[model samples]
Target chain A: MRNLLKILYTYHFLLMFIALEVISIIMLVQNNRYHSASYAVKAKAVSGSIYSTVSDFKEYLSLKEANKALAHENAILRNYLKSNYGTFDTTKISVNDSIYKQHYRFQDAKVVNNTVNKQYNYITLNKGTKHGIKPDMAVIGPQGIVGLINGVSENFSNVLPLLNVDFRVSARLKKNNYLGSVTWEGKDFEYCTLKDIPQHVQVNKGDTVITTGYTGSFPEGIMIGTVSSSKLKDGNFLSIEVKISTVFKTLSYVSVIEDLTKEEVTKLKTETEK
Target chain B: MIGEYIKIALRFFFLVVLQLLVLNNVQWSGYLNPYLYVLFILLLPFETPNWLLIILSFLLGFTIDSFSNTWGMHSAACVLTGFIRPYFLKIISPRDGYDSATRPIIRDFGLEWVIKYSLILIFIHHFALFYIEVFKFSLFFHTFLRVVLSTLFTFTLVIISHFIIYKR
Candidate 1:
């Protein structure tokens, strides 16, 4: 055994490379099983602690802005209640118009350590297992979708930001319903590209882009961005350039949207991937 | 002596954090993500053991892996780099070489040797990393493109970092 090992080592780095290949194969095979079980254990404790700490950090930073946003949102809700008061015919005449029917959950979170400059930028959030955050959960800001959670750390999770080249969010024109894939070119934080839209879709320079409701993260009709420009790709498909509204680098606060059906949908998707 | 070892360890920790937290995040094009923190290993004292060097490289890469969630890429690259460092030292060995006392630097290894040394190591590290991250060889075009682009970016950044940190 010693002599055989020596002979292999005499092949110098070739032996090392072969060893690595074997390890890589083994890891690929065992990754899913290992990640699920171990993630359950480790993610709960570590991610939870990190999430709380980072949440504390973020609440401080967003105190003023968050208060303003809340006040504005409150004002809008109150005004909405006033306008539709006649629609309610209850004995008490309560002002309730579709408030209970809103389909979006706004779970506040903190960005722990986010990167917008990477071709594969990932943002770590302070909401995870404890906060009901899960992988593939839709993350958004006041502007639009920040990205989806790729890995969860129990109380904390990492988001694959739209600034990352890996992100491909399905979006459509609000007025016309022309759908396309929105992806970051891994360059500018202020811009992204929307591709595969038919050139005949009649795109305007400032038409609203919103989620198409094809995936689990965001509901259909959630705002993504406005069309910055449009061009003919291969002189057929419409290639629209979009300017993302979120400031990922300077971003501090976010909302992790936990769709009620996310768990079942993700479980099915994960099984399919395996 | 204990204090010195602790300081060295702390510096290694600092380099890795800065690499992932700051430098890895700074992407100009989708093409470039520089790995300059490995310079800590490159600049180590010449008497460092071969086995320890390999282990250090593995640890360095593993840390990066844990953060990025990409399996063994950084480890493979760092290990390959560690394996090649000694050979590089031999290739550029001078009559009164700095292998025993002097460190690998522009001042010690001279301008030409330093450039040659850094370029070779950067290519080796980036090749292993990009190729490993690109597990499926089926995507030949994409893997090839990344290898070329990342190597160029890594080479430029590593050289610039060396000049700034260890200027002759």
Candidate 2:
């Protein structure tokens, strides 16, 4: 026992080093796999407030650009208004519309923090649980899909952006309805790779890709990006490169999508799997 | 002694703020992430106890991790850096050995010694950091490129900061 105590005293520095590293690694694994809501919640409140204050100053610098993007979106929305189009058939036909209920609700939020360079990137928004934002909700920019909420605090939330390596979403080609999965290769911010599309399916440059709604986080038909190129891989699957539509660097504002039927869909899915 | 401690504490605060507010936001390119916060660990007094060094390094890394949402990558790397730092210092000591009361700074040691010291430590820190971040061996060459590029970027910043801070 005396010899053992002597040995520990001599190697105490190394033991302390190992202990600290082990703790850090444990935190890393927990943060990555389970998203460690308890720890992140407190950290988010402190960091989120700092980022929001800094972003408030930055918001003014990008006001001109934000105004232009908002104006363009407003014009597009105006074109869809019922007053702009006339009905060719005036006959009143009452269809069974009660079956169609709202499946998604949107809340506008300002991006207080965003990073695209890292292998695993995250975005922070000004709105959080206080504003009804929750984990697993989808976030979309003016042009296309952004990401999904992974962590939330009282007045802030973190988004696992599509640029991250772990982010994968079900998407389909708009031209032929062929399904594939979109994943970032950690190479470029403006592009992601689409895999699992069979080689037999026709693909071409500039073909549009949209969400398939299979994940239930995002609704159907939201734009992801257009195919920049496609190649045959291993004689079975076509590895296609897609140029993402949303400009992540200049992202200022976004909409958080709350899928109202998510609980019902998830419950049904679990039952089916079981 | 108290004054020296106060200075170290101030440097810790300054470096953290600079890292989170300025360096973290600097989008030079996807590959050039210069982590200037490690400078805090690099510039510590040689007389600092080993256990205190490791704990301070962990705290510095954990603070950065909390703000950046990187969790534990930085803390792990910083602890390793701190663990190996004394050995590295011993290896690179001058023919006569280090002065008793001198801190590791550009003013105390010449530019060449400081560069040689920081370059090796920074490379190791970036190497450990990027690999822990990717956490895979498949993209070996890709992560290697990032490590090299980031080390060079960080080295240049450290040298520039030395001149900026120590200029009389």
Candidate 3:
């Protein structure tokens, strides 16, 4: 025992170093796998709120450019509303059911930490608990749906940005409504992969992709990317290549979609699992 | 001595603040971010023990991680640098060794050795940082390119800052 103690003390630093590194690796894997599963709704809201504030602070310097972006988005949203729901009474908000149908509200955030070059890209935000932001809220930008909120603190939050290898967004063809998983390849900032797409779907370069509305985090029709290239995988699946339109290295603003019906949906999911 | 202590402490806080607040946001390329803050770790008193140095590195990295929203990139790099520092010092020891050396000034070791020592550790630290950050070895070519580019940038920054401040 004395000999063992002597050896341990002699290499105590190495042992501690190894132990901490192992713990760090474990934490990294666990955080990646179970961020949403473990923390779920409440934690994400806090993170979303943090990023929102951070983005606001960062955008203060680029107010003119941001105003232009806001103006452009406003014009697009107005045109969309005019074409889709012209003269409809939006104030006649339905109590229970319509909330689920449009269960989300969008708020803007900025990238405090963004890395397109990494296998796992994370973005930190400056908004937090005071902002009413929560976990599992879908984050979006002018180009398309960004990613999900992951970590949160009292004053800040981290996003598992779409550029991460671990991210697999459920995307579909805007032209024909075919669905697949859109993932990153960790090489470039502007590109991603659309896998599990069945062959014979008539895919081509420049075909638009959008979200499938299956995850209530985002409403249907949020733009994902355009199919920049594609190849046949085996005989049935299409290995479609997508180029995301969001400019992340210079990304300044994002909107966090607050899901109103998240609790009920989560409760239903838990009950079904049980 | 008291004044010197005050100076180091203030510089430490300032460098950390600059690292988290300003340098963290500067995305020069997909592969590069400048870190002049590790100069602090590199410039610490030569006789500080292994455990304390490692712990300090861990703290510095952890604080940076908190600000930048990472798990352990900087912390891991800093600890790695601390661990290897003693061996590097031993290899580069002068005729008289560490006792007579009062500072890590360039004049003491000449510009070439100083630059070489700093670059070696900086390369190890930053390479480990980016490699672990990308988290897999699959994109070997791409990651290697980034490591080289970022190391050059960081080394330039370190050398420039030291020349200006320490005046050796």
Segments of candidate 1 deviating more than 4 angstroms: A1-3, A21-102, A185-188, A233-236, A261-274, B1-8, B20-34, B96-99, B105-116, B123-168
Error of 2 at B29 (Å): 2.3
Reference-based lDDT, each prediction? 0.70, 0.91, 0.74
- The residue pairs that clash in candidate 2, if any, are none
Between the candidate structures 1 and 3, which one is better when assessed by lDDT? 3
Could you give candidate 1's per-residue lDDT for residues A135-188 as a string of tens digits? 777888766779887777556677777876667888888898887889876446
DockQ of 3: 0.39
Off by over 4 Å in 3: A1-5, A32-57, A81-103, A108-117, A124-131, A152-157, A233-236, A260-274, B1-4
Per-residue lDDT of model 2, residues A1-274, tens digit only: 9999999999989999999999999989888653555577788899899999999998999999999999999999999997897753533323434336877898999999999888889899999889998888999999999998988988999898898888889999998999999999987788999999999998989999999998648989999999999999988999999999999998999999999888998899899999
In angstroms, how far off is A135's CA in candidate 1? 3.8
Docking class of 3: acceptable
Q: Could you give candidate 2's per-residue lDDT for residues B47-105 as a string of tens digits?
A: 88899999999999999998888889999999999999999999999898888788788
